[model samples]
Target: MKIRKKPPQEEFVSQAVRTGGDGQDAQEIAFIDNALFHADHAEDELFGEGSERIEVADWHFISPSCLEADGPPIKTKVLTPKQEKLLFLRYNYARRRIRQAQIRGAIRGTFESLMIWRQRAQDARDALVNANMALVPAMLRRVNCPNVELEELISEGNVALLRCVDRFDVSRGFRFSTYACRAIIKAFHRLASRRATYQKHFPAQYDPQMEKCDLGDRIHRQRWQDSIEWVRDMLTDNQAKLTLVEQTVLLERFAMAREGKGMTFEQIGPIIGLSPERTRQILRTTLRKVREAFDKDTAGPVQLAGA
Candidate 1:
């Protein structure tokens, strides 16, 4: 891997000098520039062209292969113990470099270099993760989780595998697979525990029939019926200040007092001795007056009977 060189700090130094107002600003700028320069030099010395670089190729789990009775074929060339150690070393070293840069306050000036190391760390981590991808399905075969889907288990196992790659200590001389298996099983156990808790709280599977509740609907319908009765009383008592013809048009148009459905303007027109348009006009006018009266009655402050 070719490491990128850090950009010269002189550019920042010159820009700061041009914009700075006093010697204090200039001194601070120079101090920052010197720290960044040393930091860049240290990074180059550590990871530059002379260092041994490990190349990681893209690898993925072939789903069809995972179904085999024996085990899934390794997607990439299986790393030897030495290669695995090197990859882990590189990954952790890159992270340490980033942390050191952050501590030294060199990150702001070395953003590009930091990103390159981050990408290297990610690549190394991915190589380890992909090489061990088969372990997930292999472990899954031994697990019996009837409630969880195979896909969800695989997903959880993959996440656990990635986390294991980050946390495993190659120096401890333990095989990565041994460490990874425990983590993946714990992940599955946690998933199972969550599923158990969820089932405890909600024991029954979702059933549309069982979920159906009509109490709210009944209450809403009763309220609507009461409102309709109140409006009928208003029309009957002439409390809405509607004229006789207006009242007749509204009652017949809406079928409020009659048994059948409401009449259209054309049907109510002949009964009221008016054209359809005229009947529609009377209905609109009656509705507006009724709405005004209803609004006034509802909006007014209520009084106690004695008061």
Candidate 2:
């Protein structure tokens, strides 16, 4: 068989990773646009067609173009493999530049460069978060959480993935997927354990007293209010029947029967220009007539001992 000559690795890879007007490969731009920006619903374009769409708001990805665009708010999304590789290169390149600046004792220069490097690192980290989002759903599938929804599980996993990206060491010669899987699963267990703890410590109890006590308290307040209103209505209705002197005495002595703080005859005597004994006599006479009228108005009127 005739042997086919292999092209240079660099040239072959360069052809595969073609760039577009946005300085990103056209295929990568398409991937990011479809997977992150253009997605109308929570569909998984990352793993290609037939993948399960995690019915949720895709708030995990942000496009670099939107970094300076006067457009709608930028949401975070996962990165494609090629995009991740490029972002990784950019981050590491910035790191090396910062290191070189520091080594040369360029303190002022390093400070300015450090800011740019930090942003580059952030972009790389965000890219990693976007790319490995599928791992969150994958991790959720392995766990058993009866109470938690698949969406919640995925949410927890995404948090774990972001944290994993921050702490991940690329020098370890392992794929980010492997590291993130364990972290996401651990996060899942932590979530389940927290829920278990809550259920164990503060279990839902069918305490009849809770409802009964609240209802009883409300009822008591309502009854007390009703009693006060009824007494005021009774006092107002009978005011016309009394003489001016009697009316003044009743209002001053009983305060219209609102608070049950009826004054003694001695207290009312000076206020009404009557002697203590005379005030007592008038009060006693008024009480009998009022009690009789009150009893006539209602079937369940309170029976006074003397009246």
Q: Can you tell me which runs of candidate 2 are displaced by over 4 Å?
A: 1-106, 149-152, 205-307
Best by lDDT: 1
Give a tens-digit lDDT track for model 2, residues 1-307. Answer: 9987655864443333233112343323211111232344322333336532232223443343332325344333545445554444444544444444434432334445545655655565555555566676555556778866666776788788877765555555566677778888899999988978877888885677675647787877676566445545666776326666776676667555456666777888888899988986776777676666666767433433331
Report the C-alpha lDDT of model 1 over 22-106, residue by residue, as the tens digit. 2232222211111222464655544569655656566565665564456654444667887787677667777665554434443
What RMSD, rounded to one decimal, does every model reach? 13.2, 20.3
Model 1: lDDT of residue 217: 91
**Cα deviation of 268 in candidate 2 (Å)?**
50
Q: Positional deviation of 174 in candidate 1, in angstroms?
A: 2.2
Question: What range of 10 consecutive residues in model 1 has the weakest lDDT sum?
Answer: 25-34
TM-score of structure candidate 2: 0.41
